[model samples]
Target: MESNENILEVENLKINFKTYAGTVKAIRDVSFNLKKGETLAIVGESGSGKTVTTRSIMGLLANNAVVEGGTVMFHDQDVLKMTEKQLQDLRGAKIAQIFQDPMTSLDPTMRIGRQIAEPLMVHKGMSKAKAMAQALDMMKLVGITNAENRINDYPHQFSGGMRQRIVIAIALINYPEILIADEPTTALDVTIQAQILDLMRELQNKISTSIIFITHDLGVVAGMADRVAVMYAGKIVEYGTVDEIFYNPKHPYTWGLLSSMPTLETNGDELPSIPGTPPDLLDPPTGDAFAPRNSYALKIDTEKEPPFFKVSDTHYAATWLLHPDAPKVTPPVQIVARQKQFAEMQKKLAAEKLSHPVEEEEERQ
Candidate 1:
């Protein structure tokens, strides 16, 4: 059985970047923890800061980046406080990341076997021959056919799916305790995507390695993750078990996201979309950042930020709609079903002037 102990903990992690335009607040007080042997999926739209959050943990941020505050604890040591040499020792030896693009992740000039073996040779002080032997075993483990025959081939020689398997082989070469897979199957076809997901699940079970899976697809999250964290504009809006999020979501953003997902029942109906673009990070809004796009936004959402409201022991959402005095607004029909869980919450909700300034002005005019 997978232990309940936390393998990684990130608390109040705030990150920013310096550009000629201005400072971009990429991550805002983002916090989550990964339990040992658990798969935690971080889902959001593009440019929502998923990749940046993972990179910060790896200590792979760009030169212009600045961590305003927070601590990342791993094995009782603060990862943010680790020295350069210490970080070098931490990456690959204890943690490994599989980037989205396998072609760019692998070296074009080097042979496949050598690239996979390099980590073992560098981290464990193993001879090249021994590392290559282990690399061959890893190749077999990741489902590369005819490993001995293709080990010496260049990256360009393999198909996209095969290349991804090679990338996975390199990531698992050292048997690291934590794996960060950033959209590892985004570039492949549907069939190949399924294969990769299954391979990851199988490998995790065998090694008991914890995973931080980042992607925008909720479908993928359904099969891979134990917990799901929905992010919008750098903040985690709603997060809980896969069932809680898909069946009984609370936040408007979560409703929009789940409604937009194409399901088996979705055939001829028009897919719903969240109105308006995401907020500009350079000048972030003081109140709820998602209020502009959320039709369910309460007046308080525009005046002050809403803190996380407890939905259940394992579920929570950040929205003024969860406030006691807020009106009981119905979710979209498509995303509404499980009302028993929050039935008491609905009773406590009192009517309020739910309209924002524009709606009130329009009504007066």
Candidate 2:
């Protein structure tokens, strides 16, 4: 059993899809822990099982999806094994989810407030009038001014950002302990995406809830995550604190991700993307899933699976390069430069903090 400190614990989870084409092994031996009130961002390229891992946690996978092995332990309960009735009861109240597209998740025909109040009324047995009032408050809490008047408006009436705010309002109406946001702002324009991300961070501060954020955007991970889990081909290639993943990445896959981030230095030049497509899940290769694309891949990486070698107390990477006997190789030139840039930024921030002590404290007071 996991503790209250650890809100969610996924252990050796293996999920499969029984499609007409073939049986696809979507999530293989995936394990991670979510601490209370922490944001754990799952970052990877598309089709890397980031969505599938979270969907499994929320009990939202399709009917044809199969749990081949292991467990998703939420508050010491195996969410994967839960019956529909049990999950239905637990979902909105205990584990709320925000999808990539708010327009599709929302009921376009219904009043926004009514939709927001649904979870509160269903889970908490609140009166309709009371829930409606609470729903309006939730909208305001999420930075929506004039929420009371907008309560009767349908989802179609709101802007994309507003619609996502409404979705967030609905997710928080019942005060869930864990919020699984799967690409919550992906579809929005960059400007609106910033607003939504800011809103989410502010809401998280107010509620102090654990958040499992799933995104293909590497940029989003650094700003939002305390820790990050980098997935590739249905397996976690690297798991570590945000600083570790960004500044001192160990895995070749992680290095590739960092090297691919667009910067002013790139100046519209195409960033270094990981070469080769991800492996087909229907027939995953026997060794490291990322071996084929990894420039630093070794003979052993192609013949055997690499264990999670410890990089630090809080960091680990599944790559043969981490082995003591493996030849030491510098990260890609771009990644090294990126790390140096980050270090300088951190030093400047620290100097500023020391030079202007108590300024923020005075503002808070």
Clashing residue pairs in candidate 2 are none
lDDT of 2: 0.89
TM-scores of the candidates in the order shown: 0.91, 0.94
lDDT of 1 by residue, 1-365 (tens): 36789999999999999999999999999999999999999999998999999998899999999999999999799899999999999899889999999999999999999999999999999999999999999999999999999999999999999999999888888898899999999999999999999999999998889999999998899899999999989899889987789888999998988889887767897898989999999999878999999898778888899999999988999999999999999998777644453454454542223436566779899
RMSD of candidates 1 onward, in order: 11.5, 2.8
Off by over 4 Å in 2: 1-4, 346-365
Candidate 2 lDDT, 43-86, residue by residue in tens: 99999999999888888899999898999999868998899999
